[model samples]
Target: MKFVGPLIALMLAATPLRAEIDITEVTSPDGINAWLVEEQSIPFVALELRFKGGASLDLPGKRGATNLMVGLLEEGAGDLDARAFAEKAESLAASFDFDVGDDAVSISARFLTENKDEALALLRDAITQPRFDQAAIERVKAQIVSVIRSDAQDPDTIVGAEFDRMLFGDHPYGSAIEGSEDSVAALTQEDLVEAYKGALARDRVYVGAAGDISAEELAALLDKLLSDLPETGTPQPADIEVTTDAGVTVVPFDVPQSVAIFGHEGIARDDPDFFAAYVLNEILGGGGFEARLMEEVREKRGLTYGVYSYLVPKDQAALYLGRVSSANNRIAEAIEVIRDEWTKMAENGVTQDELDSAKTYLTGAYPLRFDGNGPIANILVGMQMDDLPIDYVNTRNAQVEAITLDDIKRVAARVLKPEALRFVVVGQPEGLES
Candidate 1:
């Protein structure tokens, strides 16, 4: 008998990881659109609900209310107090959570199939009829105010906040989604109520479900979740524009290290050259270890511990950002290096090897995004929120694979502008009088 037979057979029979995902477009009977995929391997289920207008639609003078409202959702609902809610969830071995971001708000739940109905009922109550108890409301508001107070003491936080204020000016996007100290201090229960009023609109909600449930059952659950929601006025999208005046804007803060955040606007998600733009960034700073910014700024000169650039995309506007940290004395040199790299990339684009490697990296990582039901459900919700094509999940890798060196050069030329750089330094630069 050959004792090694079982191990060899196992090795030979193993399946290689798949990079292509089959995401099916699904619609609820009540007219809500979603993307659903079934996985029964685990005896668990997950539901994620995303709404279009996130913190962006926070009513004027009530900044941070959206975040506060979501935080308070699980504190109490229906007849359960915060403690009672927690006890019930623990007993059922389920999880319910909510989060707010710049462009959307999400409520999610995970539960064993054995306790699915109880979890669903609890989640429905939280979304449709949150109690917003006054005591818990004050407690959360105080916590937010304290965090805002503490953030003000940080030099990086100071620089970033001031940078947004300068870049966005009077736009709603410029304001902190979590809000300022004054705003958070002034927030009350009425403000939370009003925020929920706008946020829970039926038209504003999009639901995604993945697990051991049929499309029909999910549709019925979605209706029940949103039925009590008022048909309140929809959130009006803002008209955001980015303007960068080329000069170093200095905001002096007392710190040993200088924090620099550089750059202006970048291409939006829907831009025709979005793929090319992504590749251009990968060569410049998006690639973690092999990026030009890291090789030149950190590796060669030892000017900073970390220096990288990225694109932050939004519904109507997007921004390009680069950060570097060095002693106050070497701050100007770091800034010059960043600017020179920008000019160099703009004039002469990436090499073919670099371009190929970037494409391969993006394509290889694409399939890892669908490793589990939670990630798959999140992707489905994102595509629906952005009104992306149903086939986007399947076709995205092909799109990346098809990009060429010429495409990289074209997009780099358009996006990388040293002259348009909006340089912001938040600490005192040595040898320069303020």
Candidate 2:
């Protein structure tokens, strides 16, 4: 009954999607920097701000302070209570989203050109003057606890958690950013205050803005929006060299299908061979139906309904991870096939046909990511956080196109480690053990 699936297929078959974006760098008089893309066709603006050192900046033993504090940013700020703040934003026809990841706290705002100033003022107050009232704290805490409980009951979450614990041990990456129920229950107002000061500061902010704003106006707007924040935040987390034990760790769950997550040490984003590694992963596992893992495990053998792998180049560490799920009776066979494909990719590398296909798919799909001003704004911020140059959007495809078979071979030999893959399977999997 859904036409969306066929409509997308028809549209994609009609033409290759691509974006032609021009980026301009702007700097505030007070020294804040941001990327700007002017699009006068729209009467709205999308702005994205990223503060590095997100939930990872939680003080020792305070696992979810930053996340909880971020949740409270719009609950109330200045004199406005939660409902009043929501009404104010609704009146201005503006939207704000605050999210925290392991590495950064992200704030995204969209507003009409007519309401830019008022919207920015409301957003600024939320960033700098959160109330964190005791009642709001209890409410958001309960919500977070509820989410944690829900996640605890998910088989996929169980697999990922177990895999991370076995791989990263005591590192912050090993745990969920949501914090445990006990941790969330124990957080005090003082802890939230400390987390806010540690995570949202001027020194680590990256910004991107698009639509309805010029360079001069954007530079002024940047200073007005962020100049009063704290000068610095908590220090960044230390680097970690990830290592994985080669085997399976099983957590029994009452399910008919077994869910497995596997990973090993991976290349850093800044490494020279990172582009090659990315392409290699695409050919080996991430290129959807065209990937070798899918061709072998799903097409030829029908071991599972789906399988995939990806490169996770985190700020402080890197991991090559993958996921697969299959009937409990066939889960062991699926794992064996995935491992065999992994070894083949590392030993023999990809063919020229695969390299070309991956390049074309990657290049063609990238432009689809810029489908809207909001996405463009978010992309700009992400590029800034990755330390990519302003021209990366224009040059990224060429980089992918220029990769050759030899580059894939070398990167495959260096980055892929079949023997080091660690898997955590959750289910009552038959013929498989921890």
Candidate 3:
């Protein structure tokens, strides 16, 4: 035990560290803005672009249109069909990925310095002039429908869906990112085009670039890439309260083990006590083997293989959530233990030793995240999305270090409400009932 810290320090020091990132805010000639980190070490560049509204822009009945549109972005564009577009990208050794989540549609592009111009042009065409061909649209729609059908039969998926419905009611946040089969099947080519425009407009865009590029060069590239997008998007989703009352919601499935998802309302990313709460969460459940939940639920009583909790701060609402799985007869006991730990954490707080260990691990593990261009660019964009300061990377460790036992106690009392926890259990647990 005495040698643990020193061994960890040595291992961390042995790993190569990237140089301090100097991020530059660049404004394109067309008034579009992006964050740029100029790293000349590599002969390639990675760009991450995000449109803020994402699938939330889907109108009342068009829940899955944004997801389908994003999938078709790279399928075919301009004069290139699907096969030709893929072949062109392969010849230049450029890679483009487009994905849609609840809050954003993300485009990640990697290209060699020599082929940057051609690569950017191809990407621009994909984004601005996607054909939305009939064949490609049907093909992608079938694929999405297949996934939705498969999820309907999954226990975890059912629990998550029911949990969201309980929390948000009829809000867009309650719906699946890939809309249900009925909603998706009714969508048409016109709906895809409309969602495409509404979801990827310039007003909601955020950009980050890293690798062999200069701020001036990135500025021009940003314009060429984003200038053609619509100037504004549809209205953003309004913030809604997470309205889940405290209770057990049992969704019966005939499985040998029961899966449970439990949580209550959470703090936002920019909340003043977020760091303290972060450390407190680490002590409660986020610390793997070192966490109270894992120690008490998995190691002490052997209730389940693992247990964990985390902060889910979304754009509209927040949640403090955790998950565990156990034998049908033992799942109820595991939940009771979890609640006991939750209550204890809020009332008694963590010990000084727990605080110290959490800080050490968090601060030590942070610097290892910036090992490459893609990761750095992604981190920069994420920081911006979270409304962090430009120098957040340098100050993050200090923030962790500043958290005290008293700080954890205060944040724990404010953020954790043991009595408010709601559990959504799936499967026939012998000792539990809704």
Q: Give the local distance difference test score of model 3.
A: 0.87
Candidate 3 residue 112 Cα shift, in angstroms, is: 1.0
Runs in model 1 with CA error above 4 Å? 1-18, 232-234, 431-434
Which candidate number has the best lDDT? 2
Candidates sorted by lDDT, best first: 2, 3, 1
Q: Given candidate 3, what's the lDDT at residue 110? A: 79
Deviation (Å) of 203 in candidate 2: 0.7
**Candidate 1 collision pairs:** none
lDDT of 3 by residue, 193-251 (tens): 99988898998888888888899999998888888889988889899887566679899
CA lDDT for candidate 2: 0.89
Candidate 2 Cα errors over 4 Å, as ranges:
1-18
Q: Estimate each model's TM-score.
A: 0.92, 0.95, 0.95
